[model samples]
Target chain A: MMNSPICSMLDIEFPLLAFSHCRDVVAAVSKAGGMGVFGAVNLSPERLREELDWIDAHADGKPYGVDLIVPNKFAGKGEKLDTGRLIDSIPQEHKDFASGILAEHDIATDELDRTRGISGNFARNLRAEGAASSLEVAFEYPIKLIANALGVPPQVMLDLGKQHGVPVAALVGAKEHAVAQVNAGVDILVVAGGEAGGHCGDVSTMVLIPEVARALKEVGADTPILAAGGITTGEQMAAAIAMGAAGAWCGSVWLTTAEAETNPVVKEKMLAASSRDTVRSRSRTGKPSRQLRSPWTDAWEGEDAPEPLPMPLQSMVSEPALRQIDKLSQSGHQGAKDLATYWVGQGVGLMNQPLSSGQVVQQFKEEFAEAFERLSASLGD
Target chain B: MMNSPICSMLDIEFPLLAFSHCRDVVAAVSKAGGMGVFGAVNLSPERLREELDWIDAHADGKPYGVDLIVPNKFAGKGEKLDTGRLIDSIPQEHKDFASGILAEHDIATDELDRTRGISGNFARNLRAEGAASSLEVAFEYPIKLIANALGVPPQVMLDLGKQHGVPVAALVGAKEHAVAQVNAGVDILVVAGGEAGGHCGDVSTMVLIPEVARALKEVGADTPILAAGGITTGEQMAAAIAMGAAGAWCGSVWLTTAEAETNPVVKEKMLAASSRDTVRSRSRTGKPSRQLRSPWTDAWEGEDAPEPLPMPLQSMVSEPALRQIDKLSQSGHQGAKDLATYWVGQGVGLMNQPLSSGQVVQQFKEEFAEAFERLSASLGD
Candidate 1:
């Protein structure tokens, strides 16, 4: 295997970093020689502990990591608002708008009423106190790295990473963000472009990766960067490595994998989608996240539609409705099926079939080799 | 020098195709051993002939090409509407909204009134008959290639290209589009992503280039692909080539070159801007085109703003006001300076300095060499 610095640092055969919320996909990828990093934002402390314990049992002695949502700012941030206070803060108008949309699709509003007071996991985990508890549980396991998704890793998180001898990573969408992360002592930079599945900036991967790489080198920072966004194939990983990324950090590609926890309806939709099917809308998480374009997104973008609320508040309004949609869509509800969508990159167009996580790892290995050969062939004598 | 099929086909020293509207940039880039393609959408047949004559006089025996906007679908496309009819068809509300915006900036509305009768070159040339005139003028010169910006090249264009021993290229945003073009007998594919200047689709270059290449290969098509979108530097060029592109087709990077006709105020803003400074808005072109985000775009995106009219109609509304803004901004008008924006890609963030066209090409060569060396070194024994 072609070795990169990140491969040695993370103790993986390849530098590919698979980001997934499902424990099975994570363990399968790790066991297949690529390091799997479990996304822990939606998990409670007890649930995270249980998941990590399971990974520890089945990871086959391969090093794996964890990702957390520790943003610098969120609703009820510095004021330290509890879950109940946060739920109480949501406006009735926003709730009504959510229920109205579901009711239009013939979905019962009773489920939303029951879940209204339960609060959302994203809202709960994004706050300072909530993220701290998750971080505490994460460090108890042997994580090779820990990543912060929304912004620069907090000082406490950085300090904890240092104490545990684990490298800290942060995702950046621009060159200036990469510089700030490096200055903040981040060990790795996940340079994601706008074409990435979740929250992203407007820059595309082709430009952002090399721009960040050059900026880091100009500042004399030796931090390794993992290129993300619209990179599903091994050929793309090879291209990113050629652009100065130490490895490929993938997220959306795993959503269609056989062992993934992705809703089967959404998975099928993703399998049949083209790159243009995704739109970067603030409807999902109150941030611009790329998700499949559906009647739901179209309605949010319509003339009379209310502007989506910010961050956790928007997630609060969207999650319950979407959860119900997924449940009904699986049972063949036409309206729910039409409105069902999920967060995915433009690479979803290329993901036409379902493969086991291990099979994806093997395919990545073979494609990486072929891409290297192609590059070598291009350098003619 | 490294050679690809496109390099030999175009008889250029490098596989870099510089797309520009300025005659000076075209001649200079061609003289510097790279293929320079003149963007002919904004010029009349007589003006195109004049520009091509200028390029022919100064190109020093080097070959160049021309790009035209001949989309399959446009306003008044199949109806054969005259300029007066098309202008008369625009809604009064849109015209009033556009005029009010300029009036708020303290610019005189007289220039707009005078130009109201004159149809925009974009609106004119996008029609079949107008494009035919432009093509006739283009073929009078020693052009090596003719490209369609928004869709498949018309049958007449393909036939003319074959008769003249020149290649016909079409820019596409998706692999499906590439397949359609190949099936339509397009000689070359310019696979551009959402980050490209002018008109572009939602796919990022990193995914689109490889996807198109693989799709073409699967279908046994030998069409060469030129990767575009947010590709400003030679390192990015190397990355694209590694991803399966035969060459790099660049546009935004040339706008900041010394010979470019970009408005001075907007050029300064582009130099100081980051990737996030640009937004894809339909306010200017009636299509989703990426340009610098200014008060003008923000106002159009506001709640009270009318939905932007389609293509030529929106261009009709915006062109007059923007022309006045650009002219006034150059003369120290603060409001005009604030409102002045231009079509550019996210690559503007990396363009920090103004270099002559020859200098830019020389830098591309040096950067391309360094990137190749870096890739070679990574494949260690």
Candidate 2:
């Protein structure tokens, strides 16, 4: 069979799209013939500019993409609220809880202040500004695509892509959401189901792919669908294509690549994780995302665990705790290290070893070929 | 939340039934208030009689159950093939392939004859004989329930249960499956989803529970639905109840219990396993079952690996490999140990420690109570 239109059109050998904030992985995956999507969520404008510039120079002329988090659901949207007002709107109890957790870990109070405002409108505004600046950096290079995660891309992102003659992709979970993205002029739809890493919805890819593909066709929308969630090997990709997806979009498999910017301690945990090690919780981004269930997630569960605040509010409550935990984890603090968690997909279970991005891509091709041969053999009399 | 009717009617305090072949765990879970359903699939009639006798002597008058694998879909109700004829029907190449793998692992070939006639008629006969003997032993005691695992219980099992005035339960995966069981006159339906360990169907607990509940309501079938899959903690039990399930049917959680028959080495792996460690593959049972993905599973997945035969054919291929691997794993042969795999649920990730069955039940109660309180606190706010 011919490669899926989405994969072929994106000029990648595999439909896999590796999402990471690490520049090294972006460069590596692009070099390996799978698209690397730079996560622009946590980057500052200047930092993103530098990172994109680095990727542009180091990506070996292979195509790559950029991922921006633009939530369709957000607090204070269209209110024109200032950062101070939004910060003030956050409950003090939540802040105190985060502070007390960090204090218990013996993180200095001054460093805590530096971490205090790590959330709120400051981060949102930074993400927004960073997206815009990163768009400039991306346009300066030969970027293949730009994807908006968590929501529909703003009109400016679409316009920027149009102006650059590049495809603007949108990540969506539900079929209705896919239709909305298609209506919003999204060039490609990254259909992520509940089994995907990070923020996801409540549908498995087995059901979600065909549902979205049929929905797109019925609406006469030509938007190509890239299936995401719990997909790892070539056989899974073949199954997704057979189910009507234009291609498969992957993330978790790349998290353990040689170039990944994963926490050493957390990476060790991930190396041993099976497909069942994940839980979908809103503790991270205020949206339900699958991550390795560590003590940190367990704390937000069970009795006595605080009720996770809504999306952005939840971020304010947990981000500081995460920051401190990561710091102590880096320094070999055992208890804090046990609590450090990272976003991963259920497919992490299939990623049994750490290989270079190029080796991973090669393995997929080999596995895919064998799987197809087996399928054909089974079909024969 | 009130306990489900299946539990209440059966006089069992909890709906979570720990299904296993181990006598100690069966006895422990029964004493812990949760019903234990002993899997009689592999047990010989005499062995099953002995185990049931032990349970009868040890069980503290708590309600318990027995599980038998009686496939609704199987070869020859009318075809009427003998065990020897069915064994002859299996391809010689498959047997040769299995032999090569076993020999390569240094497993004794002397037991090959004993292993060859496993799964299909072999399985059917074993379960039927064992179930009959188990039923005899069970009837001698105060057995509260009897369950058919793979499909709706045979009419004989239902008849026996009816004669004994005990409820007959059937395990199902989908809403339609639940309806079928209910229509077949099943008194209890264990609605297991894809996230569950062992042999299961394609559905998640979140969507499956409500769907099955709605289906049963629409069909006017009052058969109680016990939600199974990915349920470990009491909070999950509460959530399952909220989703209309009478109670949670759990198994993987009990595998790590102190009295479990799981290999100590494998138990260590299970303890360290995050939710991501499981995969649904038919390599073991010739029918899909959620299992911990180990080097054993990886061997089956490789290009050089023999394609697993279907149903009874594949069981003959797997039983010997599993037995040999388990033996070698105990001896600390790293390669053989690596190949050791076990059927477990996605909830294995929640089992971080080896607790007694009673401790697990107690913890579930505590967490469930807290979750209810939290939900109540959020109400009328």
Candidate topping TM-score: 1
CAPRI docking class of candidate 2: incorrect
Q: Cα RMSD to native, each candidate?
A: 2.3, 23.6
* Candidate 2 regions with alpha-carbon error over 4 angstroms: A78-88, A96-111, A114-133, B1-381
lDDT of 1 by residue, B1-381 (tens): 355878878888888899998989999999998889999988989899999999999999899999998888767776655767667878888877777877788877876752443356665787788888899999999999899987888888998999999999899988888999999988889999889887778788888887888889889998999999998888788788877888899988888888998998998999888877888889887899988888888889887788888766787788778888888999999889999999998888788888998998999888776776666665555
Share of real contacts kept by model 2? 0.00
lDDT (Cα, tens digit) per residue for candidate 2, span B1-381: 133576567787666677777888888888888888888776665666788888888887777778877665555443444667656766777667666666666666566553444644345444455456656656666788888887777777888889989998888886666777888899988887687888877555544665566568778877777878877777566555654567777888888888888898889998887555778887786778889988667666665766666666677667766777787789997766666779887777567778998899888777666544433332222
What's the residue-level lDDT of B74 in candidate 1? 67
The 10 consecutive residues of candidate 1 chain B with the worst lDDT sum are B113-122
Question: TM-score per model for chain B alone?
Answer: 0.95, 0.90
- Individual DockQ of the candidates? 0.61, 0.02
User: C-alpha displacement of A6 in model 2, angstroms?
Assistant: 2.1
lDDT string for model 2 (A349-381, tens) is 567688887788777666555434432332223
Candidate 2 chain A has its poorest 10 consecutive residues by lDDT at A372-381
State in Å the error of residue A149, model 1.
Answer: 1.0
